[model samples]
Target: LKAGNMVGPRVYSTGTILYGADGDFKAVINSLDDARSSLRRLKAVGAFSVKSYNQPRREQRQQIIEAARELQMEVVPEGGSNYFNNMTMILDGHTGIEHNPPVWPVYKDVKALWNATRVGYTPTLIVSYGTQFGENYWYDRTEVWKNDHLLSFTPPSVIDSRSRRRTTAEYGDYGHIDIAKSVKYIADGGTKINLGSHGQLQGLGAHWELWMLAQGGMTPMQALRCATMNGAAYLGMDKEIGSLETGKLADMVVLNENPLDDIRNSESIKYVMVNGRMYDTDSMNEIGNREKPRLRFWWQMTRGGDMINLPVNNTETHLFGVQEGD
Candidate 1:
């Protein structure tokens, strides 16, 4: 990729390397050549990592993992709906898990696998459990989306959809308690836990994930660490942006309340600093008001705010893309 190649006003740069799979089944990588070809293409694009979309068979998965490992590429396996499938992925030693595997109750067997692997976990709780307004869920939970701060940066169209009613089948909550239990088990086990929103609602979605983690019994400190330090460590960028270290980038939020006391207190954002410059949080919210709504009022309400412009420290947000090999 060229240094000045621009997608809109933003310059594109090298970052994450994603390896898509055709289906949610094993035997996806049918041969060593197929596996190596994927690796070769990954290196050619300068991607430092790869994700197996629907996971291959145990042996196939191992071959893919070995190929990526030989070239020092991180392997993140995607776990869909099956819990046992996730267990096998962990046994194969992937670097991290993409979605929260259906690991409810987090039994002794699961703990054994986790203890043996100690891999990073990203439980995208929002997509798994966040309310879908279009489906008329969480309507009584006004505390979820009624905050002035959330509404401020949120588009008016989305704000208006809060009360709209629609009919759609939602994911059952049968596994919720177990999911939360597993989060507690894995986190307390000292495993690195990270928050994954899976596209719930942008900034608000992340906070909700944190809240879910806390509700799952993680202390505020532990949940914050999972969101910040653990995430940086997962991407091998801990030295660059996780903590308030003296040498790290000043990419941080100015919270009006101590998140340590309550995870929801994170929504009380006052200002955001990026690249040594400060931006008024209200001004950032105003930016949303001027932008046209991207979807129907009800549809927008059901999704995350992927388009929100909350700039930090003036640094260009790096695009997670494949880089040309050196």
Candidate 2:
């Protein structure tokens, strides 16, 4: 896609999870050599960065970071909800922490320490740890399945199954709110907070992250900055794509409503532009600088016509903690 061989958003991936502990996707690094070699292989296969996931020992995690630095690649380590590990990652100079710290009501000392550092935070509140997930809050309150834009791109079966029969929780019980409050504190102290949806939903999940940021008392503008400039800077692409600056790439969303007025208005998108090509937000068809209709998805052409039923296995249900009806 980056090479212009396909029509899609620009993608930068870490390829696979690099593990230090025993688990499914294994790239176990028992030594510095193992860490170096594992990273080399990922980079060779076109990974822009690496996910240093739950490396058991401090030394092991440090080895991955060291190797990543040597390879001139960014290391985004998983938080794993461990306070010590997260703090150590900041001290050891990781590119960023992938998730929020599990502990809530973060104190001034911790916030001060984090604000003093250059490490970025990408609290994936949708699947946040130590609290009810933020995704559930939207599902309970909104008709997610009826979102036309979301349904146009995502499989209806997937959206309907997850959104129709939703999970309900008290507003105060939503853990992500407290997590966002801590994020706001650190952000106010100059820590760069980036928006991360954790793939809970596609287009709409990003907006959910923005709104949740506001729930922590951040103004609409501050939350918008987290979704835009902070994310670009975190990915080291600020110069090329963060804001609408001279010599920057022409990538921006044209919204019908100003997000500064109300954070939820962020989703009032009319058109999207990428690399100077404009697209209609409703149908995702190229409109300006080119005229092209999006190709029909395989599911759309099938006999079931967007109602395809995919079988869920016992393992998948157990792994995702899905109840029988859900």
The candidate scoring highest on TM-score is: 2
**Per-model TM-score versus the true fold:** 0.73, 0.90
Model 1 earns a TM-score of 0.73
Model 2, residue pairs in steric clash: none
After superposition, which runs of candidate 1 have C-alpha atoms over 4 Å from their true positions?
1-28, 129-140, 143-146, 166-175, 285-326
Per-residue accuracy of model 2 over 18-88 as CA lDDT, tens digit each? 87677677787889999999999998988768999888888998999889889999999999989889999
Candidate 1 versus truth, CA RMSD in Å, comes to 11.1
Looking at model 2, which ten-residue stretch has the lowest summed lDDT? Answer: 312-321
Off by over 4 Å in 2: 3-5, 304-326
List per-prediction Cα lDDT, in the order shown: 0.63, 0.85
lDDT, residue 307, candidate 2: 29
lDDT of 1 by residue, 1-326 (tens): 13423211111222333334553432347666677777777679777777776644666777888888788877777776667777878888888877777545667767767876768888776555322321132333444444555554555456446534433343453344357667789777667888766655656667777777876788889888988899889888889877899999766778889988777788788866554445456445222224322222222232353432433222122322355898
